[model samples]
Target chain A: MLRSWRWAAVAAGVAALVSLPTLAGALPTRSSDVTAEELRDLVRASGAVAHEAYGESRVDLPLPDVDALGDVPELLGSTTRTRTAWRTPLDWRVDRLTVAGETDVVRAGALTTTWDSADRSVTRLLGDLPVRLPRADDLTAPVLARRLVATPDTVLSRLPERRVAGRSAPGLRVAPADPAQTLVESVDVWVEPGSGLPLRVEVRADGQRNPVVTAVVLDLELGDPGARRTAFDPPPGSTETTTQAPDVAAEVDRLVPFLLPNVLAGDGRADPAGLGTGGVAVYDRGFEAYAVVPLDRDLGGDLLELAPPGGVFATPLVTVLVGRVERTAYVLVGTVPEQVLRDALTALRRDPPPFVGDR
Target chain B: MILTELAKLVRRPRTWVLVALLCALPTVVAVFVAVQEIAPRPGTGPAFLSAVLDSGTLFPAAALAIVLPLFLPVAVAVVAGESVAGEAQAGTLRYLLLRPVGRTRLLVAKLVSTLAFTLLSVSFVALTAYAVGVALFGSAEVSSVSGTEFSTADATVRIVLTVLYVGWSMLGVASVALFLSTLTDSPLVAALGAVGVLVASTLLVTLEAAAAVQPYLPTRYWLAFIDLYRDPVLTRDLLRGVGLQAVYIGVFLAAAWANFTTKDVTS
Candidate 1:
C-alpha cells in the first residue's frame, strides 16, 4: 500500500507539471452556452458591478504577458505594474510603477498626494478624483467592458467557462468584425457569473495560441484594507508641490505643430481628428483604436531619453513616437503598428504647415 | 593535468591569433562608428549599439551585441573544436594516453581549458571595445528601453550581467563543437560541422513551416540577451537561454565522456 501511494504521488506531481500553463486558474466547468445578445447583456451587467463598491478593494494590475516576438499590441512604459486599493467613496492607496520604479499615491476625501520615490519628492493636489482620467488599472470591469462592447464592427461570442480569481466564471471572446481594419484578432474576457466583475482579460493577435496581452487578477479578498484617515495624509518630511491640471486647448496650441490630413473614421466618413481634452487625439476605425497625446515640455526629457531618439518606443500593445517638427515636440501613442505611426509622423513632417506661429 | 592543458592551450600561437581576431572586430566597428559622418539610424543594429555610438560607456554591451551572432560563436567553435580533436590530428593523443592521465581527467581538462578560453576571449572583446568606444565617444548615463536613466553603478552591474549572460549563452555553441570534436579526428571538420549545425538551426528558425521546431533549436533564444536592457530586466527568455545552454552542456558533455571513456586511441 505504501508503494502504491508513492506511485500515486509521483503520478500527481507529473500531472501537475504537465498542466502548469493551462492551469492558470481552475479548469473549465462548462462550455459556452449563452447567445451573443445574452453575452452582451451579461458583460454590460458585469460592467455595472465593477462600478459599484462597498468595502475596501485592492486590485493588482500586472503587465500584459507579451510574447517574445511581439505578436500583440501593448502600451508604452508598460514594464511597470500597479496595485490600487481603495476604501469606497473616500480613502484610497495606489502603488504605481512597482515594477519599473517606485511611486506611492494616497487619496482621502478631496485631497490626493503622490510621492515619487526616485527623487523623494511629493506632489499634493486637491481634486475631485485621485488622478487624471483614472489610471487604466483603476478602470475596473465596468469601464473596460462598456468600452469594448461599444466598439463598432465587433464580433462577440461566448467562450468556454474557466475559473478566474479563484471563482468559476463564464468567458467571452471579442474580435474585429472586419479583419482588414486591424492587426489584432481577438480579445477574450472571463467575468464573474453573478457580479459581472472582470476576472481575467486575454488578447490574441493573428492565430497565436499564447495571448499577446493578459491582465488577470492573481489574488482577491474583499474586505477592509484597515487604514485610518491618517494613512492618506502626505508625509511631512518631503518637499511638496501644489499644482492644478493644465488647460487642454493651451496644451494643444503649445505642442501640436501640424496635424495629419484626410483622417477618416471607421464608418467611411471624413471625420478629421481633433485634439480632445488633455491634448489627446483619439483615432478610431471600427474595432481598431489608437490615441496620440501631446507631451508636456517638462516630461519630454525622460520620455525621449528612453525611447530611441529618432525611432519608435515600443511595448506589446502601444507604440509611442516622439518627434519634433518646427521645434514643437509631438508624441503619437497608438495600438497601430510601428510602421503606421512612423508613416503618420513622416507625413506630418513633410507637409508644410500654415504657420499658426506661436499661440 | 588541467594546468598543463591550460599551458598547452596558451602556448598555441593560433589561440592567440583567434583571440586577437575576436577582439579586433569590435574595435574596428567602434572606430568606424566614431569616424562616420552620419549616425546609423537609432534602433537599427543590436539592442544598444545605436545608443553606444552616442555614449561610449555602453560600447562593451554594444560590442557583445555586434559579435554574438557570428564572430563570438566562431571563436568559441574553433577553440572547442580543437580541444580534443586537434590532439588526435597531430598524433599527440597516443602520447597523452601513454601518460598516467585518466580519460575522464583528460576530457575534463580539455573542457575546462576551452571554457577558460571562452571567458578570456569574451572579456578581452568587451574591455577592448569599451576602451575604444570611450576614446571615441564621451561617456553618458545608461538609458533603459523602458524610459528611465540608470546611474553609473546600476548600469555597470547590468553590463556585467550582460557579459555573463552572453558568456553563458556561448556554452551551447561550445558544447556543440566539443561534441563534434569527439566524433571526428580532424579539428577543421569538427569546427565546420558545428558551424554548419548553427547555420542550419538559424535557417530553420526563419521558415514558417519550421515553426514547430524553432523553440528546440539552439539558435532560437540567443538574441534574448537584449531583454536584459529593459527595466525589470526581462528574464523569461534570458532564463530560457541559460537553461537551454545548461541542458546542451549536460547532454553533450555526457555524450563526449561516454564516447571517450571506451574508445581506443590508435592515432
Candidate 2:
C-alpha cells in the first residue's frame, strides 16, 4: 500500500507540471493600473499599431444558430484556424473542414484561391481583397480594436494581466460611452501590451453576465512573418474563373432615379441637406455605421431567408433589415438597432438620393 | 540657369492663366456644392469630393483630385511641350545654343522650368481650394473613405503627400511632351500629341480586354494616391505608380536627350 501511494503521488506531480502553463496562463501576472485618459489614448494609438501587426492563429468563433443565420456565404464555421498577414495586398489562409482532408483557402492580393484536396479541384475568386466586418466568428481582434479606437468615450475598467498564446497581455473591460444607444453591454479584450494587438476578445450582450460571443487566439506570432510563398499560389491542374465584385455605387445609382420619390419624403430624419444619397446610404453615429443597399430582388437570397417577409434579423453585433420594394431588394446592415435600420430604409424610400443625377 | 529659365517661364502670361484656371475648378465645385440644394454622394467624382462637401476645409484634396486627371496634366503638357519646341520655332534655340551653355545644360534648364511649372500649378490649385473650401465649408476633421478619421494635421500631411505624388506622376506626361517638343518645332502639335497619348492610355485602361497591357499603361495608376489614406497606408499600388512614373521619366528623358543632342539647330 505504501508503494502504491508513492506511485500515485509521483504520477500526480508529473500531471501538475504538464498542466502548469495552461493553468497559470489565465491567472493575473504583473500589470500596471491605467487611468481612463490613458486607456483612451491607448485605444487611439491601438488603430495605428493593430494595422501594422501581423500573425497567424487558431480562432474559435461564436456562431449563432444556423437555422436562424441562414446561408452565410462568408461563414468560416464555428472554429477556424487562419494564418493572416494584414498588410497591403493582404495574404491569408484558412483551413477548411472537408471529408477527404482539410481544404485550404489562401488569399493573396486580389485573388482568393481555394484548394479542395478531396475533389482535386480548385476555386478562385478575383475581386477586392477578401475582407469582412468583425463579427463574433470572423476577424475579431482588429475589428474590436477599430471599434475601441472609434469609440472616443467608453467606460473602462482594468483587469488582471494574463498570458494569451504564450504572450503576456493585460485585460480591459469597455462599455459604450452612451449605453442607451448601443446593443453591446461591455467588451473585454486581452491586449498584448508590447504590440497593442488584441490577443482575445469577449463581447457581452446587454444585461448578460457571461459573454455572448468570445474569440481567443490559440496561437499567435508577432513581428516579421518572413517569406511565406505557399499562401499566394493556387494548386496545379485547377480551373480558375474570375468574378467581378458588384459595383455597389453603380447599382445604387441605377436604382435611385427609378426609386419612388419621397418613399421617405416627410421624415425629418431623412435630412437631405446633410446626407448625400448614393445607391447606398450610410448612416454613421459614431461606433456604428450602416449602409442601406437597394440591390436586385434576386440578390436577396440569404437575407430574405434569414428574416420573415420584410422582417429584421438581429445578430450580436449587427442588425440586418431585409425587405423588397417592388423589384428592388433592400438590405440595411450596421451595428444600429432594428428600428433605426427600418427608419433609415423608410427615409430612403421617401427621399430621392441627395444628388440623383449629379453622379 | 534653371532659376533663370523658371523666371522666364513664370513671366509668360499663359502660365499664370493656366494656374488661375486650375485654381478656378475647385472654387466652382465649392460654390456649386454650397449653393445647390443637392450634394454628391461620397466616393463619387474625386477621392475626397464627398468629404469636401462635409467639411469645406478638405477642398484642397478635392481640388487635387479635380486637377490630377485633366487640368493639371494638360497644364503640365502645355508648359513641357513649349519647353524646346517654342524656342526652336521662335529661332531662340540657335541663339541660346550659341552661348557658353552646353546643349545638355539648355535642355536641362528647360526641363527644370517645365517641372517647376508643374509643381507651382498643382500647389496653386491645392492652396486656392484650401482657402476657398475653408472660407465656405469651414475646417473639420477629414474622414477617409476607408472609414478612418484623420486629425486636421494628419489630413494636411496626407494632402501634401498626395500633392507630391500627383506632381511626380505628371512627370511622365511632362517627359513625353518634352520628348515630343524635341521632335517638332510646333509647340501646339507637341502639346496635342502628348495630351492625346495620355487620353488614349486612359481609354485603353478602361477596357476589360486590355488587362494584359493595363499594368504597363502610363495612366493605369494615376488615381492610386487614394491608397495613401487607407488605415495602414496601402503602398502596393502607390509604389507601383511611383515606379511606373520613374520608368516613364527615365525612358522619355533619355529619348529627348538622344534626339536633342544629334538634331541640327539651323532654326
Candidate 3:
C-alpha cells in the first residue's frame, strides 16, 4: 500500500504538471448555448459592472517611424500591460505596468491625473476629450466591444465558447455587412459570463489569418475596488503642474480650417457633435471609421516625407495619407482600405472641403 | 537528519565559495557605477540598474536583478544537483542507507539543506550589497520605480520582499536539479542536465515562436519581483510566478522521492 501510494503521488504530480498549460487555454472548446444578440447585450451591460482587472493590450501594425505623433508608433506596435480599477466610467485608474516600473493614469470625474514614476512628475488635466490618441484602455475588450457592437450594419453571430483568462467565456463574432466599406473583416470577442465584461478581444483585418490587434484580460476579479484604489495623491517632491489642455493642438486658426462635408465616401461624420475647429473630422460607415486631422507644418511635413514611394502609408490594418493644400498639411488616416483614402483625398483636392471656420 | 544535512551543507567550502561569488558580482558592478556614475539607460538594461545610479539604497534590488538571470540559478543548480548524486558518486549512499535513515527522510533532509543554502546565499549577497551600497553611495531615501519616494522603512520592506521572492524563484531550479540528481550517479551529469533545462527555458522565453509554451516555462516569471515596486503594486504576475514555482517544486520533488526510494543501489 505504501509503494502504491508513492506511485499514486507520482501520477498526480505528472498530471498537475501537464495541466498547467491546458488550463491556460488549450482545453477543448466549451459549449456555446448563447446567441450573438445576447452576447452583444451582455457586453453593453458590462458597463454596469463595478470591478477591477489586470490585462494586457497588444496592437501590431507595421507602420513607418512617424515619430512626431507621441507614442503613436509604440502604442500600435508593442504590448502594454495594464491593471485597471473601475467603479464607473467617470472614476477609474489604469496603471500601465512595465518591466521595472509603472505609470499610472487616474480619472476621477472630469479630472485626469498622470503620474510618471521615472520622472517623478504629476500632470493634471481637466476634462476628458473625445478626440484623443488611442490608449491602453481604448484597446481593452470592454471598450472595444462598446465601440464595435453598436453598429447596425454588421452581421453578428455566436462563436464557440472557449476559456479566456481562465474563465469560461462565450464568444461573439461581428462581421461587416459590406467588407468593401472598411478594412475590418471581423471582430471576435469573449466576455466574462458573470459580469459580461469582455475577457478577450481580437480584431482581424480583411484577408488576414491572424488578428491585427488583440487585447486580453489575463486575470480578473469582480466587485468595487474602493475609492482609494481609483484615487491619486501626488507624492511629495513630485513636480506638479496643471494645464487646461485641449484634446488636440488646435495650432491653426480654428475658423480658417476646412469645413468637412456632411458625407464623404458615402459615410457621415462619425461624431454626433459634428466637426469641430476644422482641425479634425471623423467619418464612419457601420463599424468602419477614419479620421482626418490637420497638424502643424513641421509634424505634417515629416509625415509627408516619411510617406513611402507611393506617398501613402498603407498596411492591412491601418492606412495613412498626407496631402498639401497650399501650406496646410491634411492627414487622412483610417482602418479602411487605401482606395477609400484616395477618394477622400481627391475630393478634398477638387471639391475641397471649403474653409468655413471664418466667422 | 535534517540538522545533520544542514551542518554538512554549512561546512562545505564550495558553498561559501558560491555565496562569496554571488556577493562579489554586485560589489564590482556597484564600484563601476559609483565611480563613473554610468548605468544602462532606463528601460534598456536590467530592471533596476538605471535607477540605482541615482540612489544606492536600491542596490540590493539591482544586485538581485543582475544575478537572477544566470549567476544565481547556476549556483543553485550545482548545489541541488549534488544533493543526492554526489553521495552516490562518492560511494556513500550505500553507507547512508545502512545507517537506516529512510530514503524519504534523507531526501527531505537534502531538500531542506538545499533550501537553507539558497536563502543563505541570497541573503549574504543582499547584505553585502547593502553594505557596499551604503558605504559607496550613501543610504539616501530611495525613489520607487513609480517616481514615489517613501520612508526608509518602506524601502527596507520592498528590499526584503525582493530577497524572499528571488529565493523562492531559485527554489524551482533547485527542485529540478535535485530530481535529476536522483537519476544519475554523476554530479556533473546531474548539474549539466539542470543547466540544460535552464538554457532551453531562457532561450524559448525570448523567442516569439515559443509563445505557446512560454507561460508554462520555469523562467517565465523570474522578473516579476519588479512588480512589487509599482505604486499600488501589481500582484497578478507575482502570484502567478509563485504559484508556478510551487507546481514545479511539487511535481519534481514527488518524482525524485518515488524514484530514489525504489532505485537499485548499484553505485
Best by TM-score: 3
Instruction: Assign candidate 3 its CAPRI class.
Output: acceptable
Q: Is candidate 2 or candidate 3 better by lDDT?
A: 3
Residue-level lDDT of model 3, residues B145-193, one tens digit each, is: 6555668898889889989999999999999999999999988888899
DockQ in order = 0.02, 0.00, 0.48
lDDT of 2 by residue, A22-50 (tens): 58655656665655446545655653441
**1 or 3, which is superior by TM-score?**
3
Clashes of each: 8, 7, 3
lDDT of each: 0.64, 0.64, 0.82
User: Which pairs of residues have clashing backbones in candidate 2?
Assistant: A252-A279, A262-A350, A263-A349, A263-A350, A264-A349, A264-A350, A265-A350
lDDT of 3 by residue, A296-319 (tens): 668778878887776687888888
In order, what are the TM-scores of chain A for the candidates? 0.63, 0.68, 0.88
TM agreement with the true structure for every prediction = 0.57, 0.48, 0.88
Candidate number 1, chain A TM-score: 0.63
Kindly provide the TM-score of model 3 when superposed on the true structure, using C-alpha atoms.
0.88
